[model samples]
Target chain A: MAVRNRLTGERTHVPSAVGRRSRVASGPHDRHHEIIDAALELFATIGYSGTTMAQIGDRLGMRGPSLYKHIASKQELLVEIVTGMMDELLRRQRAALAEGGDVRQRLSSIVAVHVQYHAEHRYEAFVGHREIDSLEEPHRSHILDLRREYESRFRELVQEGRGLDLFRTSSDRWSSYAILDMGIGVSAWYNPSGSVTPDELAATYAELALRMLGAERGD
Target chain B: MAVRNRLTGERTHVPSAVGRRSRVASGPHDRHHEIIDAALELFATIGYSGTTMAQIGDRLGMRGPSLYKHIASKQELLVEIVTGMMDELLRRQRAALAEGGDVRQRLSSIVAVHVQYHAEHRYEAFVGHREIDSLEEPHRSHILDLRREYESRFRELVQEGRGLDLFRTSSDRWSSYAILDMGIGVSAWYNPSGSVTPDELAATYAELALRMLGAERGD
Candidate 1:
């Protein structure tokens, strides 16, 4: 099965039984990426607790024991996929915020980036949001901290826009949640084959976000 | 432990080890509700596939075999909980829409009801969204039909508002998704002890929804 790498938007092939027989030499780094992608695909399809390491090996056409060479355990795979996703989201959000337009432009950019990321990384978004409880201990707290920081970026924009009088909102906090939640929701229902493209969906959501904030100008 | 009944939102007491000794007489109907509530609480805390009838019985201080008297299987419990939620949502949505109001008022009432239902029934909302995959066959499709019907109520309002020149939206479909998703998200993050009451949160979200639709007037 071919699974898309969560970190990079690239397809990584996990060989089927027939394809495994014709495999050529692949580097450990490539193997590591393939294993993570395979695990991500399974984790999203099946619940984390319901997925087994052996099933992941089966999907990749590797022996269960041989799979340990690339990854330690199932929980570690979840940690990697989720944290990697959050890290990427935070990176993009920072870049978007730094590419300053006025507050309206920045808010729109942020919402657009958010919607696009959730749409593009649907599997990561699914597992990240659904499997947060399964992520153990310090890793869970760390991921949550990252999420809070990411959410604050939206809230900060709303506050900034409010201060500048460019936006009028009933409550900056709830407005930010409404905006962010709606964008996060893209992951649940976005269909790549659907008429709306990710970029177009992102643009529409951005317009909705601006409208939600009562922005002075129309997009 | 006391579990809140999903259907009625009443707190049903499931006796602890000590409390089980002092239990008063309860009818089978009451026992059935208590069992369902316990199962709902457990399913929300632990994923559906992870929970067992043994744990449900344990939580309610009944022998595992005794549970068969109340419910047939774990899947039945899920079917009941999910379908019950969808049914109730459909009922409330119809009531909200049937109340005579302009398009704006009707839309606001529907959003308010949705946000408040999700906030009050957080456990049901959590399980309904996350455990849809766990629900079997015809039941799943049936619940989904109810959901589509419920969503159309909002979309119809948006379309009506547009026809009346009260709402100017980029796309009626995406706008409805944005409005509904934002309200559904209250289930994930709403804190009962927070400064904002559910009614207050509902009002704020309704305002945001109107703003998102580019409604002509403010609340």
Candidate 2:
């Protein structure tokens, strides 16, 4: 059974005709994205270690062997989820920061972007936060490196604010972590159907972040 | 192999003689506490679902069956770790709030106690946060009930502050969760051996919490 990539021409296992319906409909790339979406849901529900490749296939109505055609391995699925989410976070964070204003405005923008990401990417955020320890080898270190890079952005922001006397606290790593960590908490329990919209939550968080950083209100 | 609980006088699983030694050391109650402690370490390292009763027993220098004399099943161990930590958190939070003066002081006190609890019971906190989905039936709901109650304290504090015009934001449950969630973040990444002590972290978090609440600096 030759499960081949239509585009890459890479062969591993044989996907059924139903699984390989790329000549029409959504195309191969869309199917690949769907496979990842299915895997993300499973990872959030059952965790990375507990989820099997077959389960991911089952979720997509495909055979377990056929999933190999789209993705290399379950580990790859996790790497994709963790790294992909980190990349998105970094992108959003950079864009938010690039909007560029005073320290208070910049910090508020950062908070808004963060909470928005957590709300929109709840499953990805969950897998990213909870499954770091499940990763082995290069993946673990790579993800940690990305995380450190992201964390440093927050710390640097706080430091810049401190230098400008626009923010308060000890202006240390601990203070930065406190603010950033609170943003991360949104992924754990933010209910989309709840009373608050993502914008509302983000607004409130921006206010909280400002207060936390000791930004002078009404400035 | 007759393993009788000398305290409860109940026979379940028979542990080896090496496992039955209380002659020269801590009693059965202490052994029970130790089992939970060892399990907490394993949970933090490998997660709850990945950890086995035998692994927990081995960590405590006892056989799996013998460990049962002190503790019960893995589910029970998880239950003990999560509930015990919640019980402790509730106690400490209540104590801290009891010593409060005004809304600012109360909120600050809450944040300090929360950060302190996260730092002190990191393993327990980690397991509690990450392993909630794995708990079955009554246990999951029970733990969640306790969590909701704990969360409501913060919400109530925020509400009280808002009533007095001391706090900003919408004064909703979401706002309270933002503050509480950041405190929960401490358990995920707070390093005890780092330059920041628990007191220092708590102090910073308390100040941040106040700022988040829109408290005036001089107040």
Candidate 3:
């Protein structure tokens, strides 16, 4: 059977009907996205070790071999999902940094992006938090690199705020960790059907984060 | 070969000396603690659904049937572990509250207790965060009740601080969640061999929590 590797844009496995559907359902930019979506649901439910290719295949209505058409291995699939989430997070942070607004606005935008992204893509966030370690050595290190880059964005913002005398925190990294912790925790319990919308939740968290940063009320 | 029921305070399953030593080397209290420890480790690694009696038994160097002699079922074991952790948390909170300090001091003590407990009992903390949903109806509700009660301690502290005009946050419950999230995240990535000791880490977090609560710097 001829294998077409959708991930690397190379030929590795035969394009079965399931693989064909995955390719067709997701446009060129979305192929990786669909695999991540399926992975998130499976990882959240059965956890990283317990979830197998066959189970993810079942979820996507693909045969076990057909899954290989999209990705090389289970570990690759996990790496793709976690990397994708972290990449998007980094993208938002970069945008916030480049926007060059006041510290308050920039910080608010950061919190908003975090809360909105996690709320909209809860499965990815959940899996990223819980299952990233399951990836093999190179893949795991790559994910960690992305995570550290993402975290550095917040740390930089906090340090900048402190430098400008806008805040007075003892340690900028721990403060940033605390804020990110709150944002990540939203995935565990926040529900769209609940009273608060994602935007509102983000705004609320922004206010709380700003306060935590020692921003005055008018700031 | 009678099996001794070490858990129920009855000798229902009195095993032979060899079997007893191989099955449960620890005394009743020690054996129960060992089971909880084993369950916590398994649950943290594989999650609740992914872990089975056989896997936990393997951790204890026993077969599935041998585990049954100590605990009625996997669910029972999970309940005991979760409840034990929660009970310890509540005791810590009560002790902190009973220290009879002002709001900031009391809040700092609470944060220290929370971070220290979660850092020391990392596996149990992971299970408490991730696997509470897999519990059955009554057990699930009972665990949730314990969680809600535990959460209320933080909320009450925040509310008292608010009454004293210490906190500037809008929602007490949300602030409580924020503080708890920081402490919970400690279990996810804390390394004792790293730069910070658990006590120092807890102190750092306690300072951040106090700042988030808008407590006076000196207080």
The number of the candidate with the highest DockQ is 1
Q: Return the TM-score for candidate 1, rounded to 2 decimals.
A: 0.85
DockQ of all predictions against the true structure, Cα-based:
0.60, 0.57, 0.33
Worst 10 residues of 1 chain A by lDDT: A15-24
Evaluate residue B161 in candidate 2 and report its C-alpha lDDT on the 0 to 100 scale: 82
Over the full model, what C-alpha lDDT does candidate 2 score relative to the true structure? 0.82
lDDT of 2 by residue, B85-166 (tens): 8899999989988896988888888888998889877888988988988788899899899998888998898888888877
DockQ of 2: 0.57
Docking quality band of candidate 2, CAPRI definitions? medium
Worst 10 residues of 2 chain A by lDDT: A14-23
- Cα RMSD of all models vs. native, in order, equals 9.9, 7.6, 9.2
Score candidate 3 by TM-score against the native: 0.73
- Estimate every model's Cα lDDT from 0 to 1: 0.87, 0.82, 0.79
Give the Cα error of residue B198 in candidate 3, in Å. 3.3
Q: TM-score (chain A) of candidate 3?
A: 0.80
Model 3 C-alpha lDDT per residue in residues B105-162, reported as the tens digit of each score? 8888999999988788888887887777677789889889988888888889899989
The complex in candidate 1 yields a DockQ of 0.60
Model 3, residue A44: C-alpha shift (Å): 3.5
The sequence of per-residue lDDT tens digits that candidate 1 reaches over residues B1-219 is 555455667755664445332244645436678889999999988879878888999887777778998788889999999998988888888898889689999999999999988888888988998898888899889888888889998899999999989999978999999999998888888888889888898888988899899999844
Order candidates by lDDT, high to low.
Answer: 1, 2, 3
Ranking by DockQ: 1, 2, 3
